[model samples]
Target: MKQNRNFIVGITAILIIMMLASGCVNKPSEQTEPTQITVSAASTLTESFEEIVEQFKIENPEIDVQLNLASSGALRMQIEAGAPIDVFASASQQHMNLLDEKEMIVKDSRTDFAQNSMVLIVPITSELEITSVDSLLNDSVKRFVISDPEISPAGTYSKQSLVESGLWNELEGKAVLAETVKQVLVYVERGEVDAGFVFMTDAKIAKKDTIKIISTIPTSTDISYPITVLESSEHKKESQMFVDFVTGQKGRSILESHGFTA
Candidate 1:
């Protein structure tokens, strides 16, 4: 009878142990989707923003960033047309302001983070002695390029500066209007044009042996870059964090490295 009691006790203990072990077992955790946000930035910001996005992802492993680079005005239109962009980094305050006026951007989120200087660039192989803005007026500069003022902030800045200098009337005839600042750089880098007006940041990325910076063009506008969270964004929380990441010290450091002033 004692042996039977011992066996029954052993079986009860074993059952209890199995039940406890089963209760303690963990189920596999469900993987979560990363928060995805799209950033629409000015063409001149391409290199700097790309680097920043890489670092931002390292620090924010949960958020994914997508970049769409173009002229500030063109980006503004995209936002106006209901594109699914979460953030905007514009080279022109005018474009940002238009968005704000239309309630397209988060009102309190608009802030300027960096400034850029417009520059005159020419092909490095060019034998022409293009020394100054006045050089563009020479008979030798047949085909110069500027981004289209309607779509690009760089073009507007360049045109405004030339108009203020009373050189627009003559240069307009020679100007080949491109869609973006990067296109202006390409025109000069490929020797497609005699010269081009582009941001100093864009000039920095051009091939070292292909393009040369002649001079910095002073603009009537402040030339500061403004960034904002879009009002239409579905992920405002994540979007705001992205704006913070860009306007933070880390982003400034990256921008400075790319010839932009923070």
Candidate 2:
């Protein structure tokens, strides 16, 4: 009887171990659906954001990221039109404010990620001897390229800077308004404009050797880049994760490397 009882006890122990092993084997180790996150950022962020996005993918291989770069206003319009975007990074607070007013952004996810200074750039080897805002009036500086003030945050800031300096009204007709800041860089690179206004960050990535920074605008205007997760995001958790990464050390390093102030 004792031997039989012992045999039954040993058999029960083996069954229990087998059941536990089966449970472990059957349990899901990770989430099955890979989250997809889409981000709409200003064109100015194209280079740096692209680099950091690669790093983000390496860190979270299960998440897929898609980046859409354009003027902040244009992107906002798309988001308003119900385009599927998980995140937004605007060149200025005003654009963020517009989205927040419309409740397009996830509350408490917005952060002022970085700042940029306006810059006056000209073709690197241009013969024009322009030095200051006043010098832009020179006949040699025929075309002044700038982003369209109505749709680009950088353009609006540039316009405000000029108007505040009492130069906008004077330089209006000579100004060539491009659709985006990146377009302004294109005009400057191809010598389409004798001089152009663009963000310092843009001048760094888009036209470092092609153009020379004449001057960095005064910082009194406080141009900041704000990033946020969208309320309509299908992957809110992953969206916030990317936002945290950008505002954190890895993101800051990328921004700083590209001449942006983090």
Candidate 3:
């Protein structure tokens, strides 16, 4: 009888243990979904911004960043049209100003984080003796390219520099308008144009054997890049954190490494 009782007790204990084990196996584990934020930045920021985003991700593993690169003006238009953008980084103050004027950006959130210079680039194989902005007027240079001033801040700066140098009217006939500064670089790289104007950063990224920087527009016509959190951002805190990251020392280091001034 005592043996029977002992056997029953052992069976009961085993059943209890099995029940506890089964409960443990069936219990749900903790799951977390990362928050996503969209950033709209200019094409000029492609390399630098990508590096910055990577660093930001390491520091903020819970935040997922989505980058939308385009001409500053076009990005502003998208933000204005109510596209879901959490932050904006423009290659010029003009586009940021437009957003500020419309109250599309958070007040006091705008900050100029970097600067770039416009440069003239020619195909490496070209034998043109052109040396300065004035040389663009030479008959030998039949085709020159600049981003479209209507949508590209680099194009606007290029036009402003040419106008300041009293060469705008003379070069207008030979000017080829591109949609973005990268497009201008591509045109020059492919030898489609005699020469093209692009940001110094863009020029630096091109293969040395593919293109040559002939001249840089004076610094008086500086191109300032600004960043800001959008008023329409659903993840305002996350957007602000990204803005801080960009204006912080780490981001500056990345920008400077990419030939941008911070």
lDDT of 1 by residue, 1-262 (tens): 9999999999999988887788764558889999999999998898899999999999999999999998899999989989999999999999998988998888898889999899998999998879888899999889899999998999999999999999999888999999998988998999999999999888888987999889989877678999999999999999899889888999999999999899
For candidate 3, the per-residue lDDT at 193 reads: 90
Off by over 4 Å in 2: 1-33
Cα lDDT of model 2 by residue, 181-259, tens digit: 9999999998878999999888887645788889887645698999999999988999999999999999999999998
Q: Which stretches of candidate 1 lie over 4 Å from their true place?
A: 1-25
lDDT of 3 at 199: 96
Q: How badly does each model clash, as a count of residue pairs?
A: 0, 0, 0
Model 2: how far is 107 from its true place, Å?
Answer: 1.9
**lDDT for residue 26 in candidate 3, whole number 0-100:** 62
In candidate 3, position 122 carries an lDDT of: 93
Q: Write candidate 3's Cα lDDT for 159-189 as tens digits.
A: 8888888899988999999999999999999
